[model samples]
Each structure stands twice: as C-alpha cells, then as structure tokens.
Target: MRHLIRAEWTKMRTVPGWPIALLLAVLATIGLGVFTAAGNHSSCGGATTVCPPPTTGPDGAAVDDHFYFVHRSLDGDGSITVRLTSMSGQRRLPDAVPGVRRVDTGLVPWAKAGVMIKDGTRPGASYAAVMATGTHGVRLQYDFTHDVAGSASRIGPGSPRWLRLVRTGRRITGYESPDGHRWISVGSTSLHGLPARVQIGLFAASPGALHVARADLGGSIETIRYSSTTARFDHVALEGAAAGGWRRTDVGATIDPDGSVHHPGAARASAGRYTVTGVGDIAPRVDGMAVEKTLSGLLVALLIMIVVAAGFVAAEYRTGLIRTTLATDPRPGRVLAAKAVVIAGATFAAGLAATAATLPIGTHVLRDNGNTVLPVSLLTDLRVVVGTGMLLALIAVLVLALAALLRRSSGAIAAGVALVLVPRILATTSVFPDDVARWLLRLTPAAGFAIQQSIPTYPQVTAHLVPQSGYYPLSPWAGLAVTAGWAVLALVLAVVALRRRDA
Candidate 1:
C-alpha cells in the first residue's frame, strides 16, 4: 500500500500540468472569494453608527442583537416571577395610495418582554423564558430562536400579565398567570449542560424592521421600522438559595435616557418589588451577507478541480501507461485506490489552504467596506473550512472515478462538471422555482454546497430563505452526505469496471 501510494505520488508530481492545476485551484478559490468579499459594502449607512444590529438564529449566526437586559446570577435551582403591568409599542404603517384607507400605526406582533434564564449575558446562549408580547400575546422562547405561543389573552394597559420561569436541574419550565398565585404552564425545555450559575433576568426587544403587506394590495409586503416596546415589571421575586441580590448589564444597544421611548431603565427595588425596562434584543443578529454570500468563487474552484482530476487518470490511459504500471502490480484495484488517495490528498490540502485564507481576507474586506460581519463560534468557522476542503476532495475523487469508467478526459470532465455545477446553477437561477430547485439539490451531488451555508432560516425571521437568497434547504452535514454517497457509488462502479475490463 505504501509503495503504491509513493509510486502514484511520484507519477503525479512528474506530470507538469497536474501540479499547475492544483496551484490554479488554490489561486482561483482565494482570488474569487476576495473579489466577492471586497465587492460587498455594508448596507448600513456607516460604520460609526450601529445601523444593522446583531441578532442570531438557531444556528448561532448573528442576525439582530438590539435588546436591553437586567439580570443576576443564579447558581442553583431557582425560579423568577414578575407581573407585567403593561406592554406597548408603535409600528410604522405602509405608504398610503390615493383612494385607499391609510393605516398609520400598529403594534408589531413579536415585540417581547419577559423573565428569562440564560447561560450568560452573551447573545445566542442557551436559555428559556416566558414573556408577554405586544400583539402576539404570550410565548415561551428558548435557545435564542425557538418560539412557542402560550395563552391567547391580550396584553394592554387594562389587562395585567404574570410570567414565571422555574429551573429544576437541567429542565426549565415557563408559566403564565392572570394573578401571581395561580400558574398555567406555557412550555418546558431542557437547556442541556446549563451550569449551576446562570443569568436569570428581565428582557425587552423588538425587531428593527417588520414587513407588512398592504391590505388593499396582495403579494406586496412593505418593510416598516418597528417602534420599541416599553414593558413595566413589578412584584419581581426570586426563589432559590442561589438567587439573591441582582445585577444589570446592557447587551448590545445602550440604555436610553429616562424620558426616552427606547430607554432600558435600571432595575429599581423596593418593598419586595422590582421594576426594569429594556428596548433591544438579547439575541445575536444573522449576517448572511458575509462569508455565505461569497461562494460564487467556489464553483469556479470546483470546475478547475474536476478538469484536473479527470485528466489525472485519463492521461495514464491515453498514453497507455496504465498497462505498463499494472503489469508490475497484478492487482488493478490497488492501483485505482492509490490514484484516488493521491488526488484526494492533494485536493484536500489545496482546498484547505485556499478556504482558510479566503475567509479572513474576505471578512476584513467586508468590514473595511462598512459591512456588518456577523460573528460565529470558532467551531462553526472551523467546520466551514474543513468542510470546504472535504467537499473539494470528494468532488475530485468523484471525477477520478468517472474518468476511470469512461477512460476519456473530455467525456469524464464534462460529465463530472455537469453533475456538480448544472444542478446548482438551475437551483440558484430563477429558471426553477424554489421547490424544484430544492429537490434538484437534494437528489444531486450539488447538494454538497449546503456545507458552505452558515446563516440558518429562522421561523421568526421574515426573509427570503430560498437558494437564490443564500440559504440551502438541507443542513450542512446532511448535504455533504448526499455528495459523499454519489462519490462512493461512482468509485465502486469504477473499481468494478477496472477489474472486469482490460486497462
């Protein structure tokens, strides 16, 4: 096995064009990524002002993080209960057309304020809470992106609402009550690995913009700037050995002045009662416009790799080198495997270096251009880098297998490139609708591109999540598996073709 790999490596290096092709793959991937990144300017007016705030979805990509919080650490099992006296907000109405009824102001449905238990003060942490919303009534929200509605009772100046969050071990239960004493369970969730110490607090946040369709005109949704929510909390009480004196810290947007509409007032305590007000989100923003948007270059890189991999094996057959090489080693399968190992190894190395370089350079360019770059965990970034390399390597191997079966560079390269690129093009372009595009991606090797998707489609967020909108229908790993299955199947057929037929 070792000798076979060494021989194949020697042959690969001796070929002048193969090495140049690998180098081109690296340059094209990085160059295209940088160009795409540099071209993306921030939509927010300027860098000095926080135009697009940070908020995130379930996948932890930053979305909109404008919110206010007043909290304290709870080191053990505990519960926090508070009476929501009133919740109010103003929402912008769509532009009025002549002769049509002009709607001016209304409450944004998801504007929220509630009692929460969070892993920490950081955005996108694992946590759960029960809250009263502006127009959506009551909800049980967990893990920054998941929302479940509770009682249908309306929240207003005349109607008072009570929210309670109880922590028992790793499980957290949320309850709502018209009066503080009697509780109705809203929802329950387990925050796995929640530490003994966590931030349990009061929070308020409203989406910066809401999209509302004009009543008179269907299929036209207008984006409206949402007004902030002011929630008055009284009779705030905590029960647990670890819950005592509380602390308050602002997360993303700063606390506003006392008289301001967006003021996130400091919590005041007197006579076993606490009052706190906040205006922004405690969740991270989704910045889908960054790394995920710059993937056009990856397709170019994949094309380069397909040509190189197909030619690698087809050249041996073209020059009648396979017979002489196999004459020395009677086992044909070993030779095929050795060739695959060499191609996969070199492609993985080049892809990894190129992808790693592209991400940081692209990110710097985006920030310099005044674009908001959403933050992801180090783990997510590492997965993207490694996943890209694996994707390229798998595509190369798939091309090599096709070349083995066809024994013609042109035929194999064309088929291989079409298999991967054509489906993706059709899915992304308007030629196919979203559902058809999604099905093509699911059934074809192009689904591998899902590995590059960073931003998740959140149920709470109203944005285009189609392929053209920079979102993939499949999860990252699942998409990779689809492509891997194709590669494995091709390799098996190639091995069978080699064993049965003359090389």
Candidate 2:
C-alpha cells in the first residue's frame, strides 16, 4: 500500500502539466479575489466618512445598533416597567409629490418599542428588552441576535401593551402584560459579564422597509427605504438603586461635521410620560460586502481544478500506463484509493495556501477602497478560509473519481463542470427565479459554495436573503456534505467498475 501510494505521488509530480495547473489554480484564486476587492469602492457620498463600519456586538459579529433611549443609570439590582400606549411609524416614498418629499404612515414588520436594560448607551453593548413590534407582536430580544416571541396582539390607544425588564446581577428577565396588573414572563438571558452599573431605559427602534423592484432585464433588485418609529410610553415605573434623572441619548447616531447628530432619533418627556422615536434596528447586519466576495475568482479556479483532476486519472488510461501500474498492485480498489488520496491532498494544500492569503489581503483592499466589509467572528472567518479549501479538494476528488469511471478526460471534465459550475452560475446570475435558484444550489454539487457565506441570515432583521445576495439556503457544513455525498458515490462506482472491466 505504501509503495503504491509513493508510485502515484511520483507520477503526479513528474507530470509538468499537473504541477503547473495546480500553481495556476492558486494564482487565479488570489488574483481574482484581490481584483474584486480593488474594484469595489464606497458609494456613500464618495467618502468613507459617511460610510461607517458596521457595529460589532459583544460576540464580535456585525450588528445594527441604533435606537432612541431615555435612560437612568442603575447602580445595583433593578427593574423598569412601562406601558406602551401607542406605536406609529412613517416610511419615505420613492417618488416625491411635486416639490415635496412624500411620506406614508406605516411601519416595517419589525419596528420595536419597549423597556430595556442595557450595559451602556454605546452601540453593540450587551442588553435585553421586552418590546411591542409592528407586526410580530410582543418580543423579548437580547444580545443583538436572540429573540423570543411573546404575545401575538398589537398595541394601540385602546389596547396598550405593558413591557418590563428586571436585572439581577448578570441575569435579565422580561415580562409582558395586557394590562399593567397581570404579567407573563416572556423570556430571560444572562449577560454573562454585565456591569454592576447599567442603563435601564425606554427605547424605540425601526428597521428599514424592504421593497423588491423588478428589473427591466429579468431579475429583481431589493431596495431599503428610510423608516422611523415613535412610541408613547406612560405609567413608567422604576425599582431599585436609581442613580440620577433620566438622560436622553440617540444611541449609535451618526455625527455631522459640526458634531451634531445627523438623522438623529429623539426622546421627549412631559409629566412622567415619554415619547421616543428611533430610526434603526438592533439585530445582526445582513446587507454589506461579505468578506468572501474577494474570492470571486474561485469559480475560475474550479475550472483549472477539474482539468487537472481529469487528466490525472484519464492520462494514465490514455497512455496505457494503468495496465503496468495495476498489474503491480493487483487490487484495483487499492490503486483507486491511492490516487484519490494523492489528488485530494495536493488540491487541498494548494487551495488552503491560496485562500489563506486571499482573504486577509482582499479584506484590506476592500477597506482601503472605502468599502465597509461586514465583520465576522474569528471562527466564522476561519471556517470560510478552511471551508473553501475543503470545497476545492472535494470537487477535485469528485472529478477524479468520475474520470476513473469514464476513462476519457473530456467526458469527465464536461460532466464535472456541468455538475459543479453550471448550477452555481444559474443560481447566482438570476437566470432562474429565486425558488429554482435555491433548489439548484441545494440539490447540486454547487451547494459546496455555501461554505463561503460570511453573513448569517437573521429572522429578526428584514433583508433580501437570497442566493444572488450571497446568502445560501443551506448552512456551510450541510452544503459541503451534499457535495461530499456526490464525490463518495462516484468513487464507489469507479472502484466497482474497475474490478469488473478489462482495464
């Protein structure tokens, strides 16, 4: 077994074309990634100043953390309760009425207004709250990504919703009530390292309304319109360790050149009643330049990989080298396994080297060009880099296995390309409708590309979660498993055919 593997490795290295093809694959991946990064520039008023980087949460994942707050510091264990009497919002219209910018009274489905206990007024700090949403009813949300549904009822002047948050050390619990009297626990979460002194407040936040516009060509484009939410809170009560009077802060607001907040949210108080209006969200960021976008050249590298893998096995058959090689080994399955190991290892190493270099360099170029790349956790970043390498190796193995079965390089290469590349192109290019595109990615070997997705879709945030937008229907490992399943099946069939055929 050892000698057979050694002989296979020798043959692969001695072939100048194979070694050259692998090198070209690596160069293509890195070159294309860096080029894509260089091409992308900030469109935020031609300056990077207005295009601030996405806020990162406590977990270091990109998050949206903008809202209006009327808060007082709590030095110890405490609770805050408020009755939300009314919630209203307005959305900007795409077309303006003559000389006037038209606006409509409406709220995006996730607009929230409620009571919150937060570590600080700073964006991305750990926090928890019970809120009344536009259409999602009452919800308990915390730590930027966690959300638990409560009541399915809406709030209005006649029918108000009561929200409460209690903080005891690091644990925070939320409760909702139809009336201020009877309360029901919504949910609870630990802020782990919460500070002894924290901000307890009433907040209002609204995410942008998403509208999908059909393009004249064929595909659809998603556009987010500006929207704001206002909530009237009365019967506000606080318990335990209050430090001072209420403070107003437009948390996460953008500062203008004169140091004033631009498009700032507002909070007003009168007779112990508070009206808060906010213009952003508190959820994971789903829209931006994903870090993996720099690896746009990966598809081109896949082509090179398929060519090399096909020739690895098909060349042996073409030159009648397999007869001499197999006669020495005798057992065909062992020979096939040795070839698979050699090809997969070589491709994996080359891919790892290319992707590891490409990701960081491309990310730097994107930031240098004033583009805001969405921040991902270190684990997620490592997964993308390592997963891309694994994807390449799996595809190479699949192609090599097919080449063994077909004994013709062109046939195997064509089949491999159709299975892997074509599906991805159709899915991402919007050549097919969204449903068909998603299915193409799910059922085909192209599913492996999901491993490159850096942005995770959040149900709490409304955005375009589609293939064209770089969000895959399947999770990373699951997608890779689909591709692996195909590769393993092909390898098994090839081994069986070799045993029965004349070879």
Angstrom error of the Cα, residue 222, model 1: value is 9.3
Best by TM-score: 2
- What local distance difference test score does each model get? 0.77, 0.89
- Give the Å shift of residue 357 in candidate 2: 0.7
lDDT of 1 by residue, 325-405 (tens): 789787878888898999999999988988888888888777777777777678778888899999898989999999999
Give candidate 2 regions above 4 Å deviation. 43-53, 96-100, 257-260, 270-272
What's the lDDT for candidate 2?
Answer: 0.89
Q: Per-residue lDDT for 372 in model 2? A: 83
lDDT of 2 by residue, 29-93 (tens): 99999998888887662553566677898888888899999999998898998899999999877
TM-score against native, each model: 0.73, 0.94
State candidate 2's TM-score: 0.94
Most lDDT-accurate candidate: 2
Residue 164 of model 2, lDDT score: 89
